[model samples]
Target: MKDVPVYTKSQLALRNGQDKPQIWIAFKGVIYDVTDSRLWKNGKHYEHWAGQDLTLELKDAPHSSSVFERFKVIGILG
Candidate 1:
């Protein structure tokens, strides 16, 4: 199988809509495209934002990481 592309935090930041146009977030080092989700509109999710590692934040979320399964895996966070 092919390996996922790894992205740095700085590189991921460009997808925050403010910087570019896409919205991406990392959870447990795996990056997911949240662009199509209404929850991620404008690259912001409540107090969280795109281009971030959400592993630690998930603890406070109502849902688990499985929620990310619906979204596409764009890459990995390095």
Candidate 2:
């Protein structure tokens, strides 16, 4: 598998929850999965995962690459 691209804070907002389970992020023109991170916290900034009740807080607690590395994608939208 190839390394997922990185996205800045702005590019990610454009594609947030756009009828797709995934979207391409461009931090430095590279694409990656912002969903893979656990920085989204329910009732705070974002909602929780479907199967999970824990809200993600990327601002307060940025998601670690080691934890979300498995969810990385090349150029696909879920």
Candidate 3:
């Protein structure tokens, strides 16, 4: 398998769509690109924002982590 790149929180912060036009969010140390997701348009999904870890926020979400499976894996948090 190909090695996934690792990205820092600050680096992830820049991909929030508003900052770099690539909306991304991290979960369980894995980053997924959500730029094309209508739910994530403008980097805001409900009250959650992109470019940050959402591990702790999932419990409040209506869906499971598998919801991220549709997006591309951008990197792993470091």
State TM-scores per candidate.
0.92, 0.31, 0.95
C-alpha RMSD of candidate 1: 1.2
lDDT of 2 by residue, 16-78 (tens): 445345443432233345564555322122433322212233334456434444544444221
What are the per-residue Cα lDDT tens digits for candidate 3 across 1-78? 159999999999999889899999999999999999999999999999998999999999989998988999998999
Candidate whose TM-score is highest? 3
Q: Residue 29 in model 2: shift from native, Å? A: 1.1
RMSD to the true structure for each prediction, in A, is 1.2, 8.5, 1.1
When 2 and 3 are scored with lDDT, the better candidate is 3
lDDT of 1 at 17: 64
lDDT of 1 by residue, 1-78 (tens): 158887899999888967888999988888899999999999999999888888899999988878999999999888
lDDT of each: 0.89, 0.39, 0.93
Pick out the ten consecutive residues of candidate 1 with the lowest summed lDDT: 1-10
User: Rank order by lDDT, top first?
Assistant: 3, 1, 2
Model 1, position 28, has a per-residue lDDT of: 88
Top-down TM-score ranking: 3, 1, 2
The alpha-carbon deviation from the true structure for residue 53 of candidate 1, after best TM-score superposition, in angstroms, is 0.8
